[model samples]
Target chain A: MTLEIETGGVQLSTPILPASGTFGWGTELKNLVDYSALGAVVTKGISLHPRKGNPQPRLLEVPCGLINSIGLQNPGVDAFIQNYEKELSALSMPVIVNIFGESPQEYAEVATKLSNCHWVSGLEINLSCPNVHAGGLEFGSNITGVRDVIQAVRNSTNKPLWAKFSHSTHLFHLVEAALEAGSNAVVLLNTLPALAINIKSKQPVLGARRGGLSGPPLKYVALRDVFDVYSRFKCHIVGVGGIIKPEDAVEFILAGARAVEIGTGAMVHPELFIKCRNFMSEYLKNGSYESVENMVGLAHDDQHV
Target chain B: MRDSPTHFQLTITGNEKVGDRFFLLSFENPGVSFRPGQFAMVAISGEPYPLLRRPFAVSRTPEGTLQILYRVVGTGTRLMSYWKKGRKVNVIFPLGNGFEKIQNACILVGGGSGVASMIALARELHSRGTPYLLCVGTKKSGELDPHSSVFQNPPLNVKFATEDGSFGFHGTVLDLAEQHIHSFTCAAVCGPPAMMTAFLERFPDVNAMFSLENHMGCGTGVCLGCAIETRNGMMRVCVDGPVFPGKILLPEHLK
Candidate 1:
C-alpha cells in the first residue's frame, strides 16, 4: 500500500510525523524511535533568541493527558543550526523546523536563518503556543496577526510553510488569513489551553499557572476541527492532538487530515510512528484503498474531493 | 555505531513486599548495563491507565536480574505492586546522566524512596575498592526492607536513621551524617527536596552531587518536562542528568 503523500508542498514518505516540541530537534530520541518509520522530523519551537522557559513544575499529568508550560525553551535559531544542522542534514528523512518568535519581524528573521540550511525541508510556523505570554496564542487568535506572521515568514523563504494553529473560536478566519498569506498548509489544533490546580498547595500546579493540554482527550476535538476546516476551505490540513493509537490516525485521515503529527502519544509510546505506519499499511490493504491520499476525508458525508 | 538505549518487554521474575508500602520488584535484564545513578522508565505492557511511564532507578541483583525498590506513593507504583511474576513490562533503560565517580572517599545519602538510587552507586564503589558510606533515612523502620540484597552481607559500610526512632540513629539521616561530616571529602545525595536542601546548607564546603526526581512526560529528552533551572541554565533531568552537581542546582531547585 502507498503511504507516501505530499502535504504543504513537501513530499512525505509516510503520513506519520512527530509533532513539534514532542520530537526535540528530531535527533534526541534516535536510540528509542525508529526514524525510518517517520515521514519527517519536526523540531521543537525555536525563537530568535534563547529562552529559559518557565520555572519548575513545568509539566503535570492528568488521567489520560499531560499539561505543559515549557515556554519554548530553546537555544536560539543560530545555536540550533550550529548544533543540529549537520546531524539533521545527515538524516535520510526530511527535517521540518518549528519556528516561533515574539513578533512578525522575529519570525521572519528566524525563517530567513533556517532557510539557509538546505536540510530544512519546511517551516512549521508556531503561532499557537499557549505557554508563552506573547506571539504564540496572541498571533494565532487574531486574523491580522496570523497574516502578518505568515506573510513575514513567506517573504523570508520560498520553502514550504505550515501554519500551526491553536484551538480558537475564530479558527476559520485564522486559517483563511494564513493561507492567503502564503502558508502551504495549516496544522489543525495545537494543544488546547487548560489549567490544573494543586489542591494541597492551594495554587496552580504548573509554574506558568496555565499550559496546553495534549493526549487522548484531544483526539476528538482535533478531528472535529480538521473535518470542519477541510469542509469549509480548500486547504491542506495536518491533523494533530491526542493520537495514541493507530485507529486515531485513521480517524484523523477520515476527518480530512492529509498528514498527522503525533505529539504526547509518541512520548507515551516511542515506537508509535512505526506502529502507526505498520497499522496504516495493513489498514489500506484491507480497506482496498489505493493510497493514504485516497482515504483522506472518506468519512465526510459530502466529501470535498 | 553508537550504542542506543534499549526498549523492551521483559517478564517479572519476582515481586515481594518488603516494607509497609515498599516492594522489591525483579525482572529479567535486557542485557544493557546501566550507570550507578541512571534510571529506567517503566510501564505495564498493555495498560494505559497511568498514560506516561514512571521513572525508577535501576539496580542489578546478585543473580544478574534487574530490580527497582519502589514505594506505593501514587497510582503508578500502586499498579506496579499488582504485577505478578511472568508479567511483561515495557521498559526503557540506562537513561540520563549518572553520578560521576569520585576518586576520594564519598558519603552517599538517601532518604525514603530516594535510597533506591544509592544502592547501585554503593555497589559500584564497593567493587572499585572505593571507601564510601551509605546513609539511608526514612520515616520509620517499617519503611525499609532490611533483608533485601541492598542491606545483605556486602563488605560495604551502611548506616540508617529513622524519624520515628525505631531504626539505627534516632533522628534524621542528616543527623547521623553530622558525626561523619568531615570524614568524607565529597558526597552524593538523592532524596526529598528538603533533605537535599539541608545537605547543601549544612555541608556547603563539601563537593556534592544530587539525584533529582521530577514529573516526567518522556524519560527521554524530548518532552522537556523535567527541565530544572540551574546555575548554568535550564537542564533537563532526563538527558542532562538525573544526577547533577550540587553547586549547579539553584536554591529554588532545592525547594
Candidate 2:
C-alpha cells in the first residue's frame, strides 16, 4: 500500500503529476478540480522573458489527438516569479516549473532565476519542443544537444532535474544521456512530431505547419517509451503523452512509470487531475493492490501477482 | 488565461426563423450570468469536426436564460445549431472581458448574428434602467424574431430595409438611425464588418461600441489569435475587450 514518491525535498502521495502547458496555470481550471489532489502541478513552460509565441493556427485537432505549437508561450521567469510564484508558494504540492530556452545559456539563466525561489520544487528542462525549425535542427531530436542543455541547466539549479524527452529519438540513449548529465528523473515522452493539412485551403492547417501530437492516439507510443526506458535505466520515470482515461493511467503506472503526467488530456477535461486521483484509487482497490507501489511495473513482473 | 472546463445544460425555445442558416436559442441556466457584451463558448453535443468550443455572443438575456442567435458559418457552428433537447452538450461560457459602458444612455444596433450581442446589451441597459434605443437592421421585417422587447411596442420598432422594398425604409439601418442618432448619448453595434464600419462612422459624436466575432483558439487569452489594433496598440480581443469603442479602434482595424 505504500505509494510514496518522496525525494529531493519533494513528497507525493502518488507519482502522477499533470504535465506542463496542458493544465494551463492551476488557477484557470481551479473550479474544476481541487489543486491539492494531484501529486504536483507542473506549471506551463516559461522562458527567461515573456514570449508572445507563433501566429494563428496554434492548435489543430487530429484523430483522437491534437497538434499544438504553442511555442512555450509563457510570461517568462521574472513574471512567473512576480505573479505565479507567490501564489504557488501557498500550494501543498510541489510546483514543478517546466522551462524552455533558445540556447543552453538561456536554459541555465531560467533555472538560475528560479533556483532560489522556494516554490519551484523541481526543474523540467523542456528539451522536446517541436514547433520551431531552429539551426536546421531541433534540440529535442538531438541527443548531444539534449545532454549539453541538461548539463548546463543541472549545474545552474539545485532542484531535481527532469528531462522531457521527445519521441523523435531513441529511449534508452535519451534516458541514459539525461542521467549522465545529472538529471534526477526523466519524463519518458513529449509529443510525436506530426503535420495536419486542411484539404479545402490546400495549405497546412497549423500555422507552425508542424506540431507535437498528444492524446489517446499517443498513449501506446508513450507507454512503449516508459516501458523501454524503465527497463534500461535506474532513474525515476515520469510517464507522459496521450493519457486520456484512468485505465490508461493504470497502463502507464504498470509500464514502470513511477508517476504519469496528463498532457493534452486535461485540455479536454480539466477535472481529470482529480478524476485520475479518484479513478486510480478505485482501480487499485479493485485490483487488490493496496497501493500504487504494488501496481508499478506489475505488467512486466513475471509473477503477475 | 483561466479555463474553467465546466459545461452548462439548458434547453429552451430560441424563436428560430429563416433557413438552417440561423436560429435564436434561448436558455435560462445559472450559467447565463455573463457580462452584457461577453460571449459563451459552445460545442455541439456530438460531432467529429471543429472539436474546439466556438465563441458566440449572448444575443439576449431575458431572465432565466441567455440567447445566442447564431448563423452556421463553419463546421463548428453548423453542428451547434442542430443540437436537440435532452442532449448533454459541453459548453464553457461567459468567457472573455466585455465592453465598458459608462452606465448611461446608449443606442443598440445589430445585423446578422451580431444581433445576438446587441440584444444582450439591450437586456443589460434595460435592467440598469439605462436609457437606450435598440435598432435591428434586417433584410425583411418578419424574418427576425422581434430581437427585443425593450421598447413598449410589441415588435419594439423592429425595422428592415430590403433593396426590393420587402422591408422597412427600403435602405440600410443607418438610414433609420439618422433620424434618431442625436436622441441617444452612446451607441453599441454588432454585425458584419461592413455595417459596423458604417455604424461607427455615422455616430461619430456619440460613443459607438462594436462587438467583433472572429475565430478564436483556446477561447482564452493564451492563443493571441484574436487581436485587434487600436490607438493603444495590439490588444487581445479574447482578453481585453470584445466590445471596443470606435474612438479607441484604428481606422484599418475595422477592415
Best by DockQ: 1
- Provide backbone clash counts, one per model: 0, 6
lDDT of 2 by residue, A1-305 (tens): 54566632467776667877766655555655566558988878888878766555567666566777766667678978888766788887788888988788889999999999987888888886432435646566777777878899988988998888877546677677778989888886877788888899898877667777777778888888888777666457888877766778888888988788886666555556777878888887788887777777776765274
Per-candidate DockQ versus the true complex?
0.78, 0.26
Q: List the residue pairs that clash in candidate 1.
A: none
Per-model CA lDDT versus the true structure: 0.87, 0.70
TM-score of 2: 0.84
Model 2 lDDT tens row, B1-255: 333335565555543444336666666565444567778766553332344566877645444455676777766666666665555556666677776754777767777667667766676666667777777676665555444332221223334444345666676777776777787777777777788777766667777877877665556554444555578765667657787777887656655
> How accurate locally is residue A14 in candidate 1, as Cα lDDT from 0 to 100?
95
Off by over 4 Å in 2: A1-4, A7-9, A129-136, A198-202, A301-305, B1-7, B11-19, B46-50, B59-63, B109-111, B126-184, B191-206, B210-236, B244-255
Best by TM-score: 1
Model 1 vs. true fold: TM: 0.96
Cα lDDT tens digits for candidate 1, A1-305: 69999999999999999999899878988888988889999999999999989887888888888889988999999999999988999999889999988888899999999999899999999987432445345788888789989999999999999999988888899999999999999998898988999899999989889898988899988999999999889579999999988889999999899999999988979888999999999999999988999888888887644
Shift in Å, residue A23, candidate 1: 0.6
